[model samples]
Target: MRAHRIALWLAVGQLACSPGRARTSSSPEPAAPVVVPAPTRETPRAIEPPPTVTVVSPPAAVEPTTPQVDATLIEGPAAPAPASPAQHARLLDSPEDPEPKLRGGIVKELEDVSYIVGNEWSLDAFREVITGLGGGYVGVGPDQAYLMMGWQRPEFAWLIDYDPKVMRVHAMYHALLRHCGSRKEFLAAFEPEATDAIAEVLDDAVADDRVRRLYRNNRDMFRWRLRSIERKLARRRVPSWLTDDETYVFVRELVLGGRVRALRVNLLDDLGMVGIGDAARELGVVVRVVYVSNAEEYWEQYAPQFERNLAALPSDARSLLLRTRLVWQVNRDYVYNAQPLQDFLAWLAAPGVETLEDVVGPKPPAQRDRINFVLTTARPP
Candidate 1:
């Protein structure tokens, strides 16, 4: 249809030449109104990526789909021997100090929505695979921040989601963690501003206009969220360093040092422009771990987009992706339709086996809360 709609002016011009005269068309009508919203959030980077993702007013245009190019998941002609624990520890660096630096866009249209994920329900199996890789980008689910904060200790960590608002929720928590030195102090930030004068004073800097606005808009939800995190932390078994004071200091250092960035990005998208993908390309970064909690289960049309995201990343051997899948029981009344994480680089190398069903197998596993760990490193660094 597009090709068929050529200018009738060409036909008309030919006829007019017979009379040796040309006619001009009237002026075109005004264009449609378009508005763009400014990018609402960016968690600090190892070296902060400037100050914005540049969300516009009317809304940004959809990003072009990335053309699928195959990457081999098979072993290469030669590979390097793995680094030893001592060398790996040197790569882990210290939690107290982080190298700050700067680091996609947009099928996600809703910027104001976010889910409140409290606990970081863990699968112990991922620890070795995750920790094996040296420092790089670490992306995780909406759960407890401590596990990744303590274990992976990537050079930079990004809390990613399809919802900008969800990222904003993380931003609020980052603010709390950065400013409040104790669990009590952090909890107090959500209390009525009237009562928590100390919290307001301490939290004031962290509580940017957007964070305060989110608090003002959904007063109850945000409060409930803060309480939920407190309860989750209270119940979990974590490293001693994760004690409230330690966690606060760690988070404070990370944010201020620009080693932690919370991005509201669709994992299925190319993510080349705004999130960790951009950081990888722009900064020559090698990402070691990316965790997507049960999100792949919800993908429909954008399903293949996940593959694109994996392809976009530049990685080294030992990189891991952690994901969760729900297993249903015959007698159970409730079950979630989530899938496990896979070695994305391997999936690309192997032939056949195209969809999630291939990896999860035919029947739902009998166990409860099983997590899948996939090796994503295609070759040695």
Candidate 2:
């Protein structure tokens, strides 16, 4: 029995000491790392590298086409309203006033009447006649006459004298009577209180050169009769040489009224007569002639033919015919236009025209021709 016990103990000890048996507790061994082959055409397999991770970045973003909606999205404030129709209607309804009419026939008659003359009278004689008749004359040439007049006065004058040639004065008087309304109306308007005034002036007339000439010409007889009528009207002793013609009274009235200035013919129209030596004798007024050579040469050739027909005119009548020479020159030169002359003449006829510096100022030589051209073209009948 003792032998058996000892063998058993030895077996147990041998089992515990066995080489494949665990003697103490321990964790199981990890499995061996698996080996994978690279992918091949036939036996494709994925090979992973030793835990090496790779990071990939994404692409950049793009913007949208439509605008983004706002957080509030309510409609904006409304626009202001337009103006009303009543305001526009009120602006268009206002009215305008009428203008006054001008005195026409009188102005027309004054423009139409012109003086004419023949060659027999000296310029001085012609001027005296004009002055006596209460008109102003400016001699433009040896044969020419320039007469000017204004409203309310005899701006121009002519005397009725017997002339075998031209008979212009007779024609003028008849034309004036026909065209300027009745002689009675003209006489009354122009020579108010004529008889009384005539008698007074004749009584005061002395034996001066003017008085002597008046007597020698039978003007004294005419004046005596005129003064007798005036004295009877005035109940006073009247002088002779005062009453000559009713026209004389008409003229005297103009002079006394300061409507006329008795200028010498040689002083106002003849440019040749206007130098320092003779100018002082010409009185304060001066005259100038503007000859347009271009037209004058042409007219000179034809003027003689017309002169025979014109020769029978009185000296005053002939003077008027000569003044028309400028008109002919302008017509021949083709520089004539009627409107500007009419406008200028109209301006001249306006009240106080004498005081306008621009109208009466000294003109340049170049401009004088232009003025002549305009005047010749524009003068009324």
Candidate 3:
């Protein structure tokens, strides 16, 4: 029995050890795949891509280069622009530096003379008078003091005794009185000296001999002519009514009388006494005074009379007389017959109107027209 039991155990062990097969009972086979109804429209599905990974290396660095500067370029601060030609010229032409101020004392000295002389005398005359009084022109101080360089000249040293400024002032006073005298006679008395001074100045300035000779001739002729006229007027034996104040009054009254014709006739009749030449010469002066003092009447009477008188005189005499008449007329018109006879004489003595030709011949045709127009025009009351 034990052996039997052993065999059975061995058999059981062998059976247990052997792998057992699963039961062959089959599950029901899946129902034949019912073709899922094909979708009404077939749709394509997007395919998914597989994910990918990558590795990369770092990049290498490039070397840097230094910038270069251009040497020819104008890199420094800009230079100032050049000046234009006109600007340069103006700079060159500028006036020189002013002289230093004169000393106060010297200025005072000059002022003294200036106070007395004022602006009446010409600059040349002022200088001459100052120099004549032992004063040097240079180094003069305003206080009327002189700086002496040399001790030897006593003439200059005399300045120490007399004030040069005072002397100069006095000299100018005398000079003015001499040249512009109060009375006609006094002025006439100074004529010779005046003529000399004028001649000297002329000599220095006028280089042309013809012009100088012409000037001298005219002066001599005027003197002779005037003297001759005066002698004739003296012969008239008419008492002198032409004192400084009365002359203008007498002239004015005669012009007012429609007596321009009568006065002219009276003048012509007195020709023997007035000398034709002198009458002619004085005509302008007389008429001018008449015109200015009594312009309305003078124009009415004198303009026509002047034409008549001019016509009456002989051709040669006409020029001389006309010149004289013009002189009278200008004096009356411009000077108002207020000037002394001496002043009138000085004016005549000037360069341009020194002769008869200057009086009449050169008168423009326009002047004749103007004169005629005045004469024929109706009087202004």
TM-score of each: 0.54, 0.20, 0.16
Point to the candidate with the largest lDDT.
Answer: 1
lDDT (Cα, tens digit) per residue for candidate 2, span 257-373: 332212221111222222221322222221121111111212212222222212211222112211211121111111111112223334345554432122322211111122121
Q: What does candidate 3's lDDT look like per residue over 1-381, in tens digits?
A: 323433332231110001111112332111000011123233322211111111111111112121221212122211113324442333223222121122111112221111111110001101111221221111111111111111000011111101222222222222322333232432242244455654444455444333233223233322332233233223422111111212222222222221111111122122221222233232321211111111111121233333333333222210111011111121111100112222223333445443322222222111111111011111111
- lDDT tens digits by residue: candidate 1, 178-252: 666665666666666633453354347553444445444444444554464444334443231233455445445
lDDT of 2: 0.22
Q: Is candidate 1 or candidate 2 better by TM-score?
A: 1
User: How far in Å is the alpha carbon of 379 misplaced in model 2?
Assistant: 15
Score each candidate by Cα lDDT. Answer: 0.40, 0.22, 0.21
| Global local distance difference test of model 3 | 0.21
Task: Kindly indicate the candidate among 1 and 3 with the higher lDDT.
Answer: 1
TM-score of predicted structure 1: 0.54
Model 3: worst 10 consecutive residues (lDDT sum): 114-123
**What is the number of residue pairs that collide in model 2?**
19
